[model samples]
Target: MADIADPRAVEVSRSATGALASLSLAMLLSSLSTSIANVALPTLSEAFSASFPAVQWVVLAYLLAITALIVSVGRLGDLVGRRLLLVAGLALFSAASLAAAVAPTLPLLIAARAAQGLGAAVMMALTIAFVGDTVAKERTGSAMGLLGTMSAIGTALGPSLGGVLIASFGWRSIFLVNAALGIAAMLAARRFLPPGEAGQDRGATRENARFDMLGTVLLALTLAAYALAMTLARGRFGGLNVALLGMAVLGAGLFLHAEGKIASPLVKPALFRDPVLAPSLAMNALVSTVMMATLVVGPFFLSRALGLSEALVGAVLSIGPVVSALCGVVAGRIVDRWGASAMVAAGLALMAVGCAALAVLPALCGVAGYAAAIVILTPGYQLFQAANNTAVTADVGKGQRGVVSGVLSLSRNLGLITGTAAMGAVFAFAVGTKDIAGAAPEAVAGGMRFTFAVAAGLVVAAVAIAAAGGLRKRRSA
Candidate 1:
């Protein structure tokens, strides 16, 4: 096949830097939006005179919307123009942020949040895809690495920033601030990004474009069902949970079957058939599971078991992302030198060791030990994320980058839901109480050990997968 990259694509030296900065800002904005509302949940609940569970939907709605729509929107970007979709998404996100800021009721706020999620899904799907589209192949690692750094910084800053904003201005200010940031990013994108190329293929046109609507619906159903099932499972597993799981499985099976038969499937079946892409994706999923599990469980362990304040727990939790941001630029450069597979294996090994340390050291060493464990864990995760992202796209074709990016996003989301549901279940069961206030310290400690061990085991499995994938790629080469 002839190169599908735009003939008019700007040289890396000419415009790549500004383009990267714009994309990074978009990434930071989207990532920050994901977690910023978390800190304001209590405030929102109080302001609206709503129950906690109902207010929880404010977060859940955004997540579910993003997860469900990302794949479809990504494929759409490939059919249409990524730049056009990106700008549209940013506009929508900004408008939704405004709507959310002025929402008079909890329901309206949740609806606006969902709208923001839809826009975020578009931006998330294309941010990395655009990197591949715009930057030189040789420098893709560096671009991806910096992108990861922005994500880390955004995630790490969300809670702390939200807390400060809420303290000073109130919960509405959070969405208002997002709106301003979104507008700035949108403007930056417009100024820096190249005109969208619908597709590099000569035959690409709206008349010829055939979106796999059935596959899109099936995929969306699969993700939504699974996400809902996991969310419900976090509370309790029952008949409805069983039904949702069954539906998810059915939807997944149908999606696969449809993809295999369809001409232009949302996710290309051949991509998964490739040894590198498949294993890279699996590794990404596993690593995300470990990361999210720690994020969900760590603060609880510190607060309940060690009697740490919320501020102290936030500081402890911030350690990983802070370290990730610090290491991301360097890690990207290292990936350029050493290749992604080696770095990924090393990263997984480091994560395993860190998780192991958390599993054992917390009981003996206490809060300081927990902090030390995170110090070890964060760098490994940052390294793994950068390398794994590079690895997934290394062999992907230009035309397929959007869907591939979507798959990567999907993997991370699945991992997030899985880690939260599975690890939360184990922790709750181990502690013998869902209510942390009543849980005994010994029980909480035991739960923490078990959870970390499980996380470590997951990382070990990821290491094996990475090794096997690397060997396979070497043989193929």
Candidate 2:
């Protein structure tokens, strides 16, 4: 029980812990959408008679909207109130999930997914920023560990749950489940969480808190153009390939210019100048790229090569996150004893082992082979992911928490996109064909091998970066 002697301290603790629980639930719902549809993707493709490129859009659209809107929304939360943004996001997300479940056409599904992504952006941006706002500095590591644990559990369960739903009922069940969860979360948030604190300021200014609309527009264009180029590069757009490449570059340049000169930038350029933050952000991007690539590509291998069912495939894939989540608790304790840098480095080392094991999984004979590999890798991934978040936030002041959270979110999204695009291309190339439209079984296996190897290589690179650039927090003299 918290001490009631000091009313101000007690109030802050009660409010913050209550907010944390609500936000964790909201975050769980958001994460459910992230990987929940992964298992159902192939099923949806078969139902819609959609091309591979088109089906990829189902995943791409959600992530794209999240990437574009996360920074802006986080900034909005800081300017206004996290509680207000969180409740609103929950409402919007629920409505979008309902629409997604009943979507008739591919385009409608994509639009609904985008709306869901917007809701996700709101939830992710606010929850992370709220952690920095609500909790005292000394307890920050523990709060992050708990939050990270929730994320790992949500992500780990998402695919298996989606697989089970699709197997028994239908794909629509995934979205319906999200809607139910969202409604419950919304009610909880409204009942317990505080209202907008924008009017009560400790020197913060809402008068100058207009959203950087132009910066937001430019950033969206930049991300869209990049997606377009990646899609074209994969030979999706037959004739307009060169045009897509040009558009991507032009959009990138415009976004840079907008962010550089704008007073209220979509992404504050000044944050990048922080020696501690920049490398940590870059490390997150690289690390995420590796994790997402494995998630995206590894399953294809399991289903294609090992002949695993969707349910079994999701279960097998989840082993790593389960291990990672458990290890995150241990890592949090370790971070308290040592420093974030040690845990981060150790986590990356574990990830390297996992990636290597994944690459060589086919060589092993039975269930033990796969399990052994997962044991080596998953805990590492979870530990590093949590450590990175805690490390990044610890160094920044309270006022800059929202922007930092947004930047981390943006970095993560970009990494996932880049990893999927680049590695998807690499896998296609390994199979030695532009169109994997209907690849042979053996060729698919070979492609999977290539993808896993590439993922492993990326993690190894990340480990190097972490070792070379990762620095421990300094003790007070």
Candidate 3:
């Protein structure tokens, strides 16, 4: 079971188109499941006669499962077989969706959702890795961008589609629809995706590769603890939150220690030392943090500061995803034409400008101002995403692509959590109040300005990091 000369760099084959389509659907299903369930929370609450906090687990369970096991499953795919595992994941997801649709109780539904998330973890982790195996080297950025477009579309479509389904059918219809889509995705993946190159199929890789079960357990616990601390705080940090944070810290230390001892580590400590991978991952986190700020801060600014109606507020918030969806493919082409390195720097710069615009324009204009800033910001994000993903994943070896993609995804998710909790605190602090709901319009507007000012700084920091990494590489060369 010798490795392919360059397993990760392949020419486009006849099946490449279908493989990309299967991968796109996997990305869509994973992302769509994330947001679609949010719109159903209230309905779930009423159906189960439960409190909001309890029903929130319907979302949390899915999220936590992915956060915890995404990396482990990715590494598992590397060991077992990406094609075989991803196919299994789709089947599991479809089955779990059906179980969720028919769940007789709240706890059972939550369990089903958690199982579904586990399946999604495998799909999400492997989809991007497959891009390198299927697409040509020169067109990698375009493929990454296509996946980005699918993800954005899924996120944008989830709430609207979920609402329609809930209105026409029942709360159960959403999960039922997912079941059908999952089946379709499974069939496509099985039929279209090419078999793994020489060693990647469950031959020598399976026989020789070691899955770090201990490291995986420790990481999953740590991530779960950290995620719970973030979500459960609800803007109010209590003793439980503190304890959870402590647990996360302890778990991280243990995970690191275990990783240092592993033969085939889940995440190689050396990967972060690589100039391209480290900076790209760091930028991904920093950029994601700034982006999440828009979500956390946008609703308050729109409703409180701009005095927009709820309908208007929803529409305004929708602008970001719409822009992101539209720009994803365009960004990929730019990355392909210009190269990933240049696009990464360019993307970060645009985002910085967008942040500054958000800080000032809304204070001067109105909803138009906010929309304009988002227009600038969203394209930058898409550019950064496509370029960054292409840059880091373009050169990974056959054995490491799955875990590398997983780590990339992990960084983005962590950044989202950080932005939500920490940046939200910054916004609250700027508003000069803990209860943002009660803040004056002027104060809220001021908060918007202050928050974006901070977001701009974060983007600037990302630029600096990227520049520094590039300089170091050139100096060493």
Candidate 4:
């Protein structure tokens, strides 16, 4: 693929709409499975008789696999053919989900989950690359907004839908549904997308086109170390903290060294040359961290503090994604008028305010106070997310799209892990010091308040990064 300064410079067929929808649907399914499983986790653990630390691996496996493979798999797509990769990914994802639906033991289940992550990586790597092929550059924001909206909807609805399914059917229903969705996406992708070579190169040198093997190993090692260290630091492995920490250091050093020498690096060092990409990536990661933390911590608060039923708790938690979806729908139009940076800054401001309000739930005026704060926060976060994605995607040419998207996606995943782990640590520390066991309502409130405040601080830092990084000069709206 050649670097077209303007993706819109090429003529796009009207039929590409079908391709976009198919691709977006695949993305939605992939994101939906993640959140759906989040709610179904407790049920799965209870049914399987798994310990908390062990069950955490179920989620961690998928995330870690996806994080590690996205960039490398994406580069593969660039080498093979986007359509071929998409079909393969969808097939793998469906097969893995079926395996997950039938697994009888923890190891089988974990293996199945890891397979799903690999499938997801393929799907993720190819989906966005296909988007670049299907849509015009000028309309990328709008198209990405549609994708973002669908993702938000899937994310928001996943938990409630999973809860209902778990209540009516068994926990396996979640994986079964993913299989069904995957099958559907596979069929749709074949029918709608034109068959072609996915990762073809028209360039001069084979050396430049070779996969960044060292970089891939480094990336995998880096994420593994981080995940392992977090697990150890949580005291899951009573004596492995020092070893885990050492692994983290070693992995970081290897990743940096590999990134520098690779001709076709997973993370192109040139991306950092753009003043905006680095900070934008930071903001993306931090915001996701906050979102994940809140998502994880909120359930405990609603269940233990407010005494809400699981169904009601899911409904309340769903509000943000719902609003965020709506905001994403509108954000594209807003970005067209206001520019990407303004939208980003505004969205961050909204998230900050929303987080602050949620952090102070104990001080709310009435029963509806928490709900209102959620409504406020969700829309902003979603809008900011959509705008930020569009900006990052547009920052580079077609050749760089997959890699950029992969790294950006990786950052967000890392953020989610960090936020969840850190907040869990905070809540655990708070509860450990409390007089009551299982945490009193007041103690729950205090813990949540502290976490939300910390989340708010992170968002504020994102805002400052956006402002200080010369974004104002670029987006003058």
Cα lDDT listed for each candidate: 0.86, 0.75, 0.91, 0.77
Which runs of model 4 end up more than 4 angstroms from their true locations? 1-14, 39-52, 164-169, 194-204, 231-242, 427-437, 471-477
Worst window of 10 by summed lDDT in candidate 4: 197-206
Ranking by lDDT: 3, 1, 4, 2
* lDDT value, candidate 3, whole model: 0.91
**Candidate 4 lDDT for residue 38:** 83
Q: How far is candidate 4 from the true structure (C-alpha RMSD, Å)?
A: 5.2
Angstrom error of the Cα, residue 317, model 2: value is 2.3
Top lDDT hit: 3
| Per-residue accuracy of model 2 over 359-424 as CA lDDT, tens digit each | 677646434566687787777766776677778888565546676788887887778777767777
Which residue ranges in model 1 land beyond 4 Å of their true spot? 1-14, 200-208
Tens digits of per-residue lDDT for model 3 on 384-444? 9999999999888888888888999988988998898988999999999989999999999
* RMSD, one per candidate, in order: 4.4, 4.1, 4.6, 5.2
* lDDT (10s digit) by residue, model 1, range 1-477: 896866456454456778888899989988899789999999998999999999999999999998999988888888778888899999999999999999999999999999999999998999988988777777777888898899999998998899999999999999999999999989888877887677543233455457779988898889999999999736588899889999999998888998888556677777788787788778888888888878778878888899889888878888888888888888888888888878889889889999999998888999888988988888888788888888888777666778889988889988888888888887888778888567888888999998889899999999888888878878888
Candidate 4 per-residue C-alpha lDDT over 1-477 given as tens digits, one digit per residue, 9 for 90 to 100: 996665553333535877887888888987888888887778778988988778777877887789778877877767666677788989999999999999999889889999999999888767766666776767766776787788887887787789889999998999999999999999889977877654434332555777778888887877877766665545243457557668778987877777777566666666666676788889998898888776777877777877888778767777778776777767776766677878899999999998898887534642366788788787777678767877877756555666767777778877877776676777666655433237787787778788788889989999998888755556754
TM-score of 2: 0.84
Q: Lowest-scoring 10 consecutive residues by lDDT in candidate 2?
A: 468-477
